[model samples]
Target: MKSGDAARLMGWDTTRLSRILRGTYRVSADDVRTFCGKLGVDDPAGVEEVARVAEEPIGEGWWAAYASRIGQNYLDFIELEAEAQTLRIQHPVIVPGLLQSPGYVREMITRAPTAVSPAHAEMLVSIRLARQAVLSTATKLHALVPESALHAKFESGPAIMRDQIRKLLDASQMTNVELQLLPLTAHPTYGSIGAITVLSYKHPWANVASVDNALGGNHIDDPQQVSFLEKEFAAIAEIALPVDKSREVLDEYLEGLRK
Candidate 1:
């Protein structure tokens, strides 16, 4: 049977089916049994065992510890980031979270629309630092940041902003990272709308997209939405500076800060 037909028979959307197959989505024992029955699996005993296992609760991931401190939406995004094989991120006004420096994180948190305490702010900074671990792994990260982000003034002043730019320069040199600067001279098609991230997993149909807002953000798993964001990322990359040129932009900005 065709995969599309199988998905339809199970009454599952492509995104949900992909998540379930990837073991990221929860499934009930009845649902597991129905899937096995639909597939005509001969081993009733095996199906029962599989259903039993499905009934067990999934264990909490490391990020679960931060549930009370952060919103559920942000936690969900972190999990997605942890599992993504490649991330395409475009930020119009600020550095991407995974690429943000501790000082930048603290400044952004301080200026957040919803105020947070010092302790909570520190936790958020630690979370951003921890998220950077994926850059050291095989996961590929491509960031398209506008040149204006480097020039944006922060209340904390030049020193922190300088540190932020330096962090971008350092991240640009990583083997698994690609950094592009969207120059002021070149206009982006849709990048200025908001910060968006397209995360693609090892599974062919498991791609997702997210748009960051003042609040946490929305995780979009619809195939059509994800595809549009993917294409938008490609278009933005076309208008952005090349990796070497992007690094040069960072260098110039950092030099300006030093002066």
Candidate 2:
């Protein structure tokens, strides 16, 4: 069937449908269900698969109850992350979401004002860990962490911090992953305002930026924003410690936990 015809059947605008087909915009769970119903996809498994790839794995029962209420951008980020070839993450206060250990994630969520229940927190951790699959893939990961983040302790306590640092050490050992530390003595610059992550795809056409905010986050796809983020990332990488030195730093931190 023609693209326009399929779009019309699904009740989507032709241009929007084209973008989804081209992978420029993410297809949401709702979109998947709508398409399945319109296209006469009756099998339950078929409908579930369509929604599964498009949505974040929120486990079985909970996602169905609250899927429509969540932020669309978060769902889009999940899809973008899955397709990334290279990920450049700059973290100031907390660890990068993908690199965060399960204990750390649980601590953060439980400490929040609207604290998540134990089950929900576990689900979130599962999602975060699943996101790490990209790191194991052929994707190249570059993570720049401010020295302060290393010093800050989560509710998980010193042991958790040590384990988390050890995980970072292991990840850095991988040829595809480079973890850099921006020491506390470093001068402030443009990227100091907030955390940022830039994901570059092997396809050349799929570059994106996840810009941070005090209240929430924003995804940047405009060429100008993407170019600016790329430049900032380059500068941060240049000023941060080299991979070997960064690993040494992490080791030192872990040792201090024992003292």
Distance from true location, Cα of 212 in model 1, Å: 1.0
- Per-prediction RMSD in angstroms? 6.4, 8.3
What would the per-residue lDDT of candidate 1 be over residues 116-170, giving only the tens digit for each residue? 8878878888888888888888999999988877777877778998899889999
TM-score of each: 0.78, 0.72
In model 2, what is the error at residue 221, expressed in angstroms?
1.3
**Per-residue lDDT of model 2, residues 92-160, tens digit only:** 777787777777766666677776677776666666677777887898989997777777666556877
Q: What is the C-alpha lDDT of each candidate?
A: 0.84, 0.77
TM-score of 1: 0.78
Could you tell me which 10 consecutive residues in candidate 2 have the lowest summed lDDT? Answer: 57-66
Candidate No. with top lDDT: 1
Candidate 1 off by > 4 Å: 1-57, 257-259
